[model samples]
Target: MSRIQCPRCQRPQSHCLCPLIPCLDSRTRVLLLQHPSEVNHALNTARLAALGLNNAELIVGEVFEDLPRLLNQPGYRARLLFPADDAQPIQTYGASDEPLLLVVPDGTWRKARKILHLNPLLAALPRVTLADGGVSRYRLRKAPGPGALSTVEAIVQALQVLEAPVSFEPLLRPFEALIEGQIAAMGEETFRRNHAGK
Candidate 1:
């Protein structure tokens, strides 16, 4: 019989401790425009971040068709959260500042590029990149570059850039546990395979 999967981690639900996921108190609003393919991914970090933050909105779709009108309705500022290369610098948020828009395009390198190209509205937003000198915890997926950070990690760094408090730190702690749990599950699967061969 196949091993039971963890409902939270989707690994072997027995090993999933996603319930331990931390919540964050943030003033800056986070808008996650994720691809539909990424919504159900077990390794997707955007979902984790959304779960942690109170002002986070995760929209899984092909385009930002009605997004602009929605933003116009209430307190919302639009900004694209991509790499800050030669494009533009990350903006700073003030105490009475408008909502900081964080558009995280979730997918593989090719898929992400497609998401950007296909969505003109998102492409038109002010692009801001993260400048963290740390490695990514998204071991399951290969990054396009050294600066390629996961959605959650990118948000944390962005929050720091905006001078938000350490309230977001707690949101990242479970990520380490999530990675460790995944690695352990993989090891267990490998051990079982080897034993069966023997």
Candidate 2:
């Protein structure tokens, strides 16, 4: 029989980490523009990030037609989380009554670019990139570019800068759980050998 998968986190029953998900109330609105191909990827962190945050939303598509409407709503400023040459560091944006709408594209660099190009609203949004942090802890997938970050890491860093630092660390609980579980399953010797670079 096939293993039962948890619909929420999409991990198998024994490996499910939903119970560790954090409940965070964010002042900013986070919307994940995910590639359809990333939906079932074992290493995908966008869904987990969304699940942890109360104000987060996940939309799977290459071209989101409603993006413009969402942006035009009152009392919110929209910014795309991407590294364009013109993108300013996210830390520069201080607190405000105008809530922030952070649109993060979750996929390969090429796919993310496709999403940006296909949607004029996405392309036109002000771009903001995260501050440089340590290397990624994701051993299951490869990052696509210089200074790349996992989707979850990006969200955490953004929350730390935009919200409170304490507000985002709780979300890392399940993320660490996922990594630990995978390491155990892979065995010490194999995990050490494979993760030498991480």
Per-model TM-score versus the true fold: 0.79, 0.90
Report lDDT (Cα) of residue 41, candidate 1. Answer: 72
Candidate 2 lDDT tens digits, 1-198: 989999889899988889999888988889899999899887678989999999989999887878768666566788889888999887634555476888899998888888888987788889988886546766655565556778898888887887755568878788878878877888989977777565
Colliding residue pairs in candidate 1: 5-12, 5-13, 6-12, 6-13, 84-129
How close is each model in CA RMSD to the real structure?
Answer: 5.1, 1.9
Off by over 4 Å in 1: 1-12, 84-86, 188-198
lDDT of 1 by residue, 1-198 (tens): 988876544545665656767766676778777888886676667777887787787778776688666455366667777754555666567667876656677766667778878877767777877765657766655666676777788888888777544546767866767766666767966645543223
lDDT of each model, Cα atoms only?
Answer: 0.70, 0.82
lDDT of 1 at 115: 80
| Colliding pairs, model 2 | none
Give the Å error, residue 144, model 1: 2.8
Q: How does model 1 score by TM-score?
A: 0.79
